[model samples]
Target: MTETHVPEKLKAPVLGAVITVSDRCSRGEAEDRSGPLALARLAEFGVEVAHPVVVPDDIDYIRSALQEALDAGARVIVTTGGTGITPRDNTPEATEPFIALSLDGLAQQIRLAGLAATPLATLSRGLVGVSARGDRGALIVNAPGSTGGVEDALAIIGPLIGHILGQLSGRTHEVESADE
Candidate 1:
């Protein structure tokens, strides 16, 4: 018998949440551009934004917000800010417990690409992982605080979103041409 190869296409509806982890933003003292930027970027991919929130940088606060978004049915959660080396940056620590699988390669790629523009990008200690809490699954990634950094991360992951969603939904067909 000969083995046949088949291509896969994503059918599951993709929902997203954007969390801006900044104390001032949560307090309404600062405007949130990162969360909105994430929402806009994901919108181009046809992913619906389910919950967009601004939370304090406290570890527990960020963790609770993430849990809330996940519970609200967000299949992808993109977080900005609080991933640096500063004392107040606790997004990474807060998200550690909820992670099911860490995608180090994706995180590394983001870092590598960002490094070309600014050395400060190397200071980011952001992470990417999957959540084990839901039946639909969620991919959680920490994007840099800067607008350019966010753009770089989005560009790097944009093409992969559909493929990732397809795998998560168990679809098996080619949805777009390689030229896309």
Candidate 2:
């Protein structure tokens, strides 16, 4: 597998978490493929990923999972599933309340990249943003449930994790200088 390069400025491995939002998976009637894929992808970028959690496609459950990840010290949390147009697709809505700064460009980039693979990507309502709760907030992103969707989202964010985290921890100047 082709691995995304971890930026040199990243002095340490970043902590990450993955949440799979699918009723069937949560009910144990179906396997959760997206969550594992997300975890592996995050690990490929040198992220220390926490064990993934599976949740039903409910806003409350999704929100709780987000809080759980945050409480567990996850610096980046990726929720795979519930990003489609279906009635159960509530990842974006669940994640919105936690966002202190919206990363519209990153969200758009994921969609734009996905469009190259499938036109249905346009229907995805995934979101990307930062949840500024403590001295350092976690970066939260909502990705579709499909394996392809998870790949697309990770491919876009993998290389930028360090820089984004740096910005979150008030190291914007240092991160910027490294880019120069």
Candidate 3:
């Protein structure tokens, strides 16, 4: 079979994971549609994604899922769900502790792009940030539970993953001055 061409400039197969945070899905009362969708989307960007995981909306459960991904060497972890304004939405709260640096622009871009489709996008409290591990850190982001939100986020993240990863690994195209 012919290989699917990735639209991004990823230098390597990025190790990534997808977490679906939903109380119903975790309890098997609902199917995890978003997690699979997220994995497929990341694959389209040439990301080497791990098996999708599902967790409840509880902060501890969400954090455990994220921690597991990080421990497994995932360089990027995109969480689906738990970003709305509802009380059960806890992905952002769980994720904040891991963020050493916030990528506010990227997060804002997701919301802005989403606004073109629906005003409710403004209600999504998703965030993008990198861990404190510096060169060994991972880019963690929370995408709204809906498939459209995941698509919107990937649209912004896909093209930039290479550069973001590069920056995290201390790779840059900037030329140094001789004065240094």
Summed backbone clashes in each candidate are 4, 0, 0
Top candidate by lDDT: 3
**What's the lDDT for candidate 2?**
0.87
Give per-residue CA lDDT, model 2, range 1-180, as digits (tens): 334444544677878899999999999999899889999988877788867899999999999999988888889899999999888899999999989999999999999989999999989999999999444699898988999999999999888887788777776442233335
Per-model TM-score versus the true fold? 0.84, 0.89, 0.89
Model 2, C-alpha of 46: deviation from truth (Å)? 2.2
lDDT values, one for every candidate: 0.80, 0.87, 0.88
How well does candidate 2 score on lDDT at residue 81?
Answer: 90
List CA RMSD, all candidates. Answer: 5.0, 4.7, 6.1
List the pairs of residues colliding in candidate 3.
none
The local lDDT score (0 to 100) that residue 159 gets in candidate 3 is: 77
Candidate that would win on TM-score: 3
How much lDDT does candidate 1 score?
A: 0.80
Which residue segments of model 1 deviate by more than 4 Å?
Answer: 1-13, 133-135, 170-180
Q: Which stretches of candidate 2 lie over 4 Å from their true place?
A: 1-9, 133-135, 173-180
Candidate 2: TM-score? 0.89
